[model samples]
Target: MTVMELSNLSVTLRRRDVIRDVSLSVGKGEFIGLIGPNGAGKTTLMRAALGLIPFVGNSSLAAMPLAERAMAVAWMPQQREIAWPVTVETLVMLGRTPHVGALASPTDHDRSQVDAAIRWMGLDDMRQRAATRLSGGEQARVLIARALAQDTPFVMADEPVAGLDPAHQISTMQTFARLAEQGKSSLVSLHDLGLAARHCTRLVLMSEGRLIADGCPAHVLTPERLAEVFGISAWYQDTEQGPVCQPLEVIR
Candidate 1:
């Protein structure tokens, strides 16, 4: 099943195209790694798809009513700003608001959801800590756990692993991969080609506001594409540990 679809999507800001004509579909159980250079419009595409920005195109996810969309998809934006001095548990429990209602107290199921999300992000020990007091990387994990607690079928995360430690980064990707196995889909924008290649079931390569390539990890992370789009050379191999890919050097 296609969980999200964007057809001929385009976004303009200041009379310039931030996201040009682009189209893509995210399906059930597929971990889609949205990869591209810094200004490739990956962020704009996700925002436009979520109806958060003005755009010219059709996005099935964007078409849904706001309330319905909130329950259908969970979004973890790149910015990690903890506005409230809430505890880790309180913040994650907020993810259940759509189901529990803002004024209603959490039920057993909501508590369970928050617990699971906290455990997945290795925050069990700090569940009672104030979110604003945590370090940058720890704060990132807390925000991720909040998204996980939402437990939506479709998850869209922008640079979710940006500030995480090496172990947490891999673990976070693994968490998304496990979710995919359970028929959930995740569209994640990542700068770490190695992690994206190893964990994602499919990859979409964006360049200059367009999707330049889409396929399995091997196909999308080809050396030529790396050089052309990323201006770098990378090493890729099929190993017992799985497909390993790393940018070797900036050849351009």
Candidate 2:
């Protein structure tokens, strides 16, 4: 089943187009990676999909209208420096916002989901710690836990591993892979080419408001395409571990 659909979608910022004529259909349990250079409309496309920005064209989540799509789609933006002193558990609980009533308090079920998410993200020990006190990697996991607590069938994460170390980065990627295998469609924007190629089942490459490539890692992420779209000389090879990408040098 199609979990998310965007057709002829266009988004503009400051009167300039950021995403244009982009269309995609994401199926259930699919793990997709959105990749591009900085300011390549990867984040813009994600924002449009989540209805966070004004977009021209059609976008639907589970065939529902934009306003009603929140019930089924959950989003976690790039991790930023959060100042609030809320506890880690409380922060994850915020994911329940879409499910709870405006005036109602969290029920036992809500608490259960929050606990489960914390455990799922391996954050059980830090449940009572202040969110602002955790390390960069821990905070990233906490945010992901919040998204999991949302329990939506689909999730969209923008730069989900911006500041983490290599170990944490790979761990988080594996977590997303497991989530997709468990019947949740997950779309993640990643700048690390090798990580995206290694983990994502499908790749969506965008640039200058255009969908440049979309296919399996081997077919779409070629040296020619990387040089053309990413402006870098690179090569992708297979090893015993998995696919590896080496950026030779700047093409210029």
Candidate 3:
């Protein structure tokens, strides 16, 4: 099933085009990595798809009503600001809000899902701790757990592993891969080309507010594409582990 479909999507902010006419679709069981340089409009495209910002053209996910969309897509933005000093469990429980409703109490199943998410993200030991007190990487895991607890068919995360350690980074990507195996779709924006290449089933490359390439990791992460879009040379090889890419040097 096609979980997400965007056509001619465009987002303009401050009288500037942030996301140009872009079209893409995500199917079930696919893990798509949205990769690009900073300010490449990855986040803007996601926000537009979520209907958080005004944009032109069609976004199937954005067309859904608010409550329905909540259950259909779980989004984790780039910012990890936990304003409330809530317990880790409490924060993660918020993911069940779509199912439980705003004022209603969570059912037993909701609580169980939250617990599962906490365990999945390796936060079981800190479930009772204040989320605000955790380190940045720990908090990122907590936030990811919350998204996982949503248990939606489609998950969208912007730079989900930015602050995580190397182990957690690989683990988190593996978690998404497992979700794909379970027939869920994921669209994640990532800066780590190696991890993206290793885990994502496909990649969508964006540059200067436009979609540049969309294909398998080995196809999209070509040295020519890297030098053209990223202005750098990269050393890439298909290792026993998977495709690996390391930026060699800047072209300039």
Error in Å for residue 139 of model 2: 1.8
Ranking the candidates on TM-score from highest down gives: 1, 3, 2
The global C-alpha lDDT for each of the candidates, from Candidate 1 onward, is 0.94, 0.88, 0.96
Candidate RMSDs in order: 0.8, 2.0, 0.9
Any residue pairs clashing in model 3, and if so which? none
Candidate 1 lDDT over 1-252, as tens digits, reads 999998999999999888888989899999999999999999999999999999998999889998899899999999999998999999998888788876787999999999999999999999999999999999999988989899899999999999888999999999999999999999999999999999999999999999999999999999999999999999999788889998999997
Best by lDDT: 3
Per candidate, the number of residue pairs that clash is: 0, 0, 0
Better of 1 and 3 by lDDT: 3
Model 3 scores worst on lDDT over the 10 consecutive residues at 97-106
> Which ten residues in a row are the worst by lDDT in model 2?
61-70
TM-score of each candidate? 0.98, 0.92, 0.98
Query: Mind giving the per-residue lDDT tens digits that candidate 3 earns over 155-231?
Result: 99999999899999999999999999999999999999989999999999999999999999999999889999999
- How do the residues 23-117 of candidate 2 rate in per-residue lDDT, one tens digit apiece? 99999999999999898998889888777788988888534664467778888988466679899989999999888888999999999999988
Model 3 spans > 4 angstroms off: none
Superposed Cα RMSD, model 2: 2.0
lDDT value, residue 66 of candidate 2: 44
lDDT-sorted candidate list, best first? 3, 1, 2
- What is the alpha-carbon lDDT of model 2 when measured against the actual structure? 0.88
